[model samples]
Target: MIIVIDALNRHRFKGLLDEMHRLRARVFCDRLGWDVMVRNGREVDEFDALDPAHVVCLDADGDVVGCMRLLQTTGPHMLADVFHGLLDGEPPLRSSRIWEATRFCVDTKKLNGGKTRNSISYVTSEVMIAAFEYAREAGVLDAVAVIDPVMNRVMCRSANAPYDYLGTPKPMGKVTAMAALMDCSEERIQAIRDFADIRHDVFLTEDEAEALFRSNREAPAQRTAPPAPFPESKTEKADQMPKLPRAPHSNALQQYCYEQVLNAKSQSDVDAAQALIEALSDALGTTSAAELARLARVEAQATRKSVLVAAK
Candidate 1:
């Protein structure tokens, strides 16, 4: 399945974004030998800070296995800035109706077979289909993709070959990179889908997506943030709990319940915390509160157990 993550909902899927950056590092930096900046095992650039929409392909386990980045052509994009040499001294393409697609990659380690158009393990076509569909939905008419000869052939085999090429291909590192313009229309989307035999929706429900992100956040390998300090005692913790910072959807009641769950001292307190979460979810008419409550309770219980173990 594929999920469209943009500036609006990126906060809710930080873990997924982290994984995508790491995957890019593995594919572009390590495998393709692209001279890109990689930091702390992640491939992030200024474009990521520009709030581009990402078309992410998830495996059956809801893990991000493939992704492509889309940026508005009117602004600073790869062809205009990084790969300007490929333009042959011509002005870079810039238009609101046109967008730039770059950083296209897939997790080869997760693939079960060869990189073929019909192979079930290959996700290149699926990601391409999702990208075009998403761009069309976003009102973009065309997309310019920066791809190598290998990916160009892959696009041809997938039945979604580019309609036109910009400048001539130029040697970049070990491979040649060129600009390919693609039409973001139903015809192109259908061609890729038909070639891949995908007829169903390729997106996850809100609940499934939330659960997947939560699971990724709780993974041990993702423990990059500093630990929440343990208080000397339950009373001290109650007095020292930090105030919840204001956010886009700051809910006073939800914050109160969160702090209650965090400072919970007993099984009764935990039950009350869960009940408050259910009530809040019902009042807000959102399923996310319940999921948040579940995560809070799990974290609280784990912390409590750890404290008990330390005291022993």
Candidate 2:
């Protein structure tokens, strides 16, 4: 199996889009039964602008076996509109800290690498490697997916994915799943690429996938198998995550600024807010009690919202 991780050009993009629609029609509209919109055997949506989109391919003997779509979470992305209903509300997308991962599919017909490949392992490894490259190029700090609970475990175990539960796995026509975010990191991404090594056919045969599954199963017990690295602490993640800075604030705008501070993404924002609060408190040391209470109210409201969102 060969992995192609390129942004689809005009002709290539159209061809790929056609191929995607064909595959979707076969699996979704015809076999399992879904009501996806299609015209002349193609799936086209407003989102397919050829920008903020990526396509990954698994070519075996010139035949496409697997494919996935990636989208960035800029303004008007799925996370804020269509997919937002899948989760509690919109995740922190405005800070440009995370991207959305979606439209993942594998050709079951070509899975297990046909008869030539040793086992199902080859196909699985190819998929993993392609996914990591997609994540890196797309600047995806996190990936959100609505997938089967069983497959969710496979993602966590085989791909070293870190996730948080969003909702109960519900049936979407034939697919039963819930949404979750896979935390992206350099270490986990590298491990996937190393295991995939598509330059050689080593990871694409059936025997390899079986071995991978077996080894993964016994990985916790096997001293030689490296465990997934521990994730950074919440505070550390918050520090790394970017924050949307405040615009100029007037007396009326000061309340809004205080609210935004509570929703801060990094420690710097929190520290700044703390400093401002201290300065204001000191200045109010000789002021009337009424004025001090008004200032406290602004800070308190902002802090409450920020903490609540972070906890979720």
Candidate 3:
């Protein structure tokens, strides 16, 4: 499903946004060799801070598979500021009715296999349809997309080809970038839908989106480390711990447990930390906190072993 994330509701979907940024970093910086700033595995720029709308496609596992950014052309956009060379001597187009679309990418690695068109093409068309529908709903008349020749070809194949071009294509890094203008009309949106064979509404409800974002936040920590081996001494009695109500200060408890795990020095210390985390997880009835604690413990254990090896 596709989710429209903007500044007004960004706080509620921070996890999803983080994932989108990471995906952008992987696609643009790592794969495409784009000259974009990536910090801590997230691709973010001044445009992101300008409250642009992000149309993101989520897979069945609630992971972000594709995304496209939309910004008002009247303000500072990529074509007007960063890619002005492509415009030659012509002035950058600026209009409230026309929005700028950029940073369009998909996780091709995750969507590698399919029978007909492959997952990349499928999600790419879906994102385009969602972007056009979102722009039309927001009263936008047209969209100016700063894309490469490859993406231009993809747009043509999807039956959502641009109606006009701003200027000549100019080489930027390994790819040539050009500005293509597209109408924000139902006909364009429907064309992409039909081409992609997607007829259903590609949006998630607010509650469902929130749940997916929360899962995205907790899942990384859980997957970072294998489950800690339960110490034999505490194995039998661990299940006897009383099930308490969810703690109001669960965040604080999680932080404390994480710190404890990080400070662990030996196997016994790590075992105790794991046992404490399990106890807290049972009490709060949430695995997120325990997962974080386990991640910290695993990191500390690895560091300790490395130090021992160095000392030997």
How far residue 282's Cα lies from its native spot in candidate 2, in Å, is: 71
- What TM-score does prediction 1 earn? 0.68
> For candidate 1, lDDT tens digit of each residue in 58-109?
6634467889999999999999999998889999999998999998888888
**TM-scores, each model vs. reference:** 0.68, 0.52, 0.69
TM-score of candidate 3 relative to the true fold: 0.69
Model 2: weakest 10-residue lDDT segment is 244-253
lDDT, candidates in the order shown: 0.74, 0.49, 0.75
| Separate clash counts for every candidate | 0, 8, 0
- The digit string of per-residue lDDT tens for model 3 on 36-144 reads 8999999999989999999988764467899999999998998999999888789998999999999889898989755233388788888888898888988999999
Candidate 2 residue-wise lDDT, 130-215, digit = tens? 56555766566776655676667666655555558564555655667576776667677666555544343222222222222233
Task: List the candidate 3 regions with Cα displacement exceeding 4 Å.
Answer: 113-118, 216-312
For model 3, what is the alpha-carbon lDDT of residue 173?
80
lDDT, residue 230, model 3: 25
Instruction: Compare candidates 1 and 3 on lDDT and give the better one.
Output: 3
